[model samples]
Target: HSPYFNGANKSTEVDYVQVYKDVADLLEDNDYDDGSYGPVLVRLAWHASGTYDVDTKTGGSNSASMRFEPEALHGANNGLKVARDLLEPIKAKHPNISYGDLWTLAGVAAIQELGGPTIPWRPGRTDGTSAESCTPDGRLPDATKKQDHIRNIFYRMGFNDQEIVALTGAHALGRCHPDRSGFEGPWSEQPTLFSNEYFKVISEREWIKKELKNGGWQWVDKNNTDVMMLPAEISMFNDKEFRKYFELYAKDQDQFFKDFTNAFAKLTELGVPFKGDEKVYKFETLPVVVT
Candidate 1:
């Protein structure tokens, strides 16, 4: 009658706090990540949940449909399998947790691991059937598009201009893969840590475009640096409205964290129906103990 086995018997009724603790512990134990798995986990959670369209109420985090063939084969979903596989061990340990909750919790784990803000999370999502999952292609933002294109894509997902800018703040975590997004380099040198560096570099640096080593419409920094920005992200600087929020986020880390956490939480719950309190829970931050 092990607690772990007993816990599986009542999987649907497991406490959110215990689930959070388990995932957080797992993240702490794994040190194989490049910078931090935090950002990539954030990206994974975002990609998993961001597909929902309220109009159709079709796709969302509930199904973990990324496991299914149709969703996995999507163009925007490329490279996400790595993120999914990374969580398999955690899933094995806690068989009671739904993929939807597991994916989103991984995000909370990553953020907390990287010294970012605590993203208040709750769990009531059940495993949805494959028939319940289906978001059209192009729902996710295209890296190569312009500001208007970014607006069109995100807006369709029911995000406003402010939320759109806040959501892109996730670029602070992961980079554009030449093989995946057809874009190259990390958004910042420290892609694993959570910071406003993405906005800082985009606003302060002078970017020169170079031919991509892997081909396609990719561009590298003229300074021969490792950082890269997609056509869509650069449009934030080029467009007045987008730049306004970017500047605000750059100048104030607290403001960016507040907005980003709210937007990301909203993004995760896009298509779900929850009648309980929507209060956000800020988790206790992990301390840095240097040897």
Candidate 2:
């Protein structure tokens, strides 16, 4: 049952799973900046889902209103419109799909496109009204904090320690831009592919304190001249408890993928409830073709 080949336009006949595959194809076709689109796609999904607050019910992925003024203007949301704009053509092709669903689907697309595990996604999320716009600026995690801070921010969004570690595994896919997060360089050289390289680097490399030219905390890898890490990311190494899971993930990529997929699935569904049994979709993996 090909998506473009059969029943392409029937609204009721639209398979959400096919939409996921279509977005995956698009991501593979347009991987830029780091040889892959994985990182930005992960960040796009995070920014979209991070807006949810369990207590207030004020923000969540349901709205897709980040297209509006105040939410788009958020300092934490900087560099994200690049991702949203990249998806505009896809949205244009499939007007019936909500932006909420599209953004999350893009994340799944990026992951599978870059050789990650299957992410189970569903389609009950609908676009919200313009009135339902604007989340506070600091809803996202600060890259300068420690374990306690990570716990506070993520816990506020209903994530546990395991989920936090799993979600942070996304660091393996994208680098911190000095312009965006004020952190420079990538966690792994292959920042586009999904893997447990972040943990491997932390466990295997020797880190030296980076010179502070502009009063920011950064680190240099003892083994490599170019790789770096943020204070927040390094804390995963400094803390005893966090390091345990990090080491486990570092040793096994498959375990990391499994844990990450489960955690990401939970992360995207922060405040939504399923009316029936939950369904998980496994996407096909693309061949590794070097260009």
Candidate 3:
């Protein structure tokens, strides 16, 4: 299927599984934060899909609408341009794949390669041409807010408490950059690798609030200054509604991985209506020491 439809039958097929492997290779960067592009790739995949609105059913990864002006310029999308720019070369190599699929696939690759769960994917999303195709701001979760805010946002995407907890488990793999999200530090010690470490750390560690030079408050590990958690992360464990699954995932990592796979698969498919045949791949990450 053509990623972009332009009034002509321009559909072409590219071996996207190979493309997924290529994406996995690109994610390893020794100089970048935690020696991997995993975190940012996760963010890229997330922002690309998180725009779903149950009421209007307008946003999602279907159009890759973030490529347009106002969508790219939204405050919530601050610093995502880097993720888009990093993916440019892959897009150049395979022009037939739409940005929607490319971005979403990149995320799936990051998760599998960085030590997370399998994500089922299908292609059929067409690219949108203008800023009007972009969604309004405020669809993503704000790390500074509490449970209610997290619920309002994810609930719009049709996630329940358990699904929300499972999705938040992704915080296991990424960190917050002071420049990007106006916050700092990784949620888990091994920030590059994906694991249930996020749930473990949030549930087991003691975090103390510390103010940055800019006056923003973030929770730091009492044992490690390099580790951190956001208000949103803390709320999951503290709030009764989310804690059941939150604690469940923390105690049982295998369960977390399974739940995350299902939740993430659904998250990416929010507005995508696929043709009957779609592919599901459980990508195997190359061992850290690849000869």
Candidate 4:
């Protein structure tokens, strides 16, 4: 009885961890944003998994439905084509892996490669074969909104205040592009790596309302306007409950890693229907390890 059975004869053993890692090996590009595909890979993984609806077990990473129209064209998913394209070659080589598994796994690999916690991921999300499986837009958080909007968005997805704070730590990894999200700048000094810096900066940085060249408002670090925080990010400080958890992460990186791993593990698996008992593997970090 071999594990990782993909319903293919149930006999041969495949090292999906290595397959995922090999795929992650190709995530670097000198010409792209952040000098690596890590940021967009994180975005791709996020947009894919962020669509889960708790009330109705649908719209998660299970099907990779974002490949289809409408969902791919969703205003929120703007500029993700690069991430998808980066993963395509790997998909071509590993014909057995589903788009859902490849996408979510790539996210895990990206986070690990970027100095994040080791995420426990399972590979049972089969490819979403039909366009009907696409989730509607608006499932993800809106950067322009405040606490109520932020809570409404995440709460609908079954996340509480503490988990929401932990998940926002991912902002530590990527910057806002005016072309994509109509917002600009990195949340941390080192935008490509994962750390509790987002929380730390959110708490300590002297911020002020600044309009980007694109004409959108965001809180920018007074020291360097090139660094910014979205309204949603600022909401953590404005709201008391959120601030408590935010302060904790800012002071303690280790605890943040553990909470983020737990919250993100739950997030990536939203709406995914695994067998009663399935093994979750913690993928090894890619050697291209950044700060």
Q: For candidate 1, write residues 34-67 as lDDT tens digits.
A: 5445666788888888888767776778777788
Q: Please, what is the TM-score per model?
A: 0.88, 0.88, 0.93, 0.92
Please give the distance, in angstroms, between residue 113's alpha carbon in candidate 2 and its true position after superposition: 1.4
Residue 148 local lDDT, model 2: 81
Estimate the overall C-alpha local distance difference test score of candidate 1. Answer: 0.76
Q: TM-score of predicted model 3? A: 0.93
Total backbone clashes of candidate 3, pairs 3 or more residues apart or in separate chains: 0
**Tens digit of lDDT per residue, candidate 2, span 83-116?**
8987888777777878887888788878777767
Model 3 misplaced stretches (Cα beyond 4 Å):
1-11, 282-289
For model 4, the superposed segments whose C-alpha errors exceed 4 Å read 1-14, 287-291
lDDT of 3 by residue, 95-213 (tens): 99989989988999999987777777777778988887889888999989999999999999998989999998898887888887888988988888888988889888888998987
Candidate 4 on 1-291: residue-level lDDT in tens?
555455556433346877767766776677777777787888888889889888987788999999999899998999999789878888777777788888888888888888899999987887778789998889998888898888888888899999999998998988888888999888988988899999888899899999667667899999988889998778767899999999999999999999999998888888887985766797777554457
Residue pairs in steric clash, candidate 3?
Answer: none
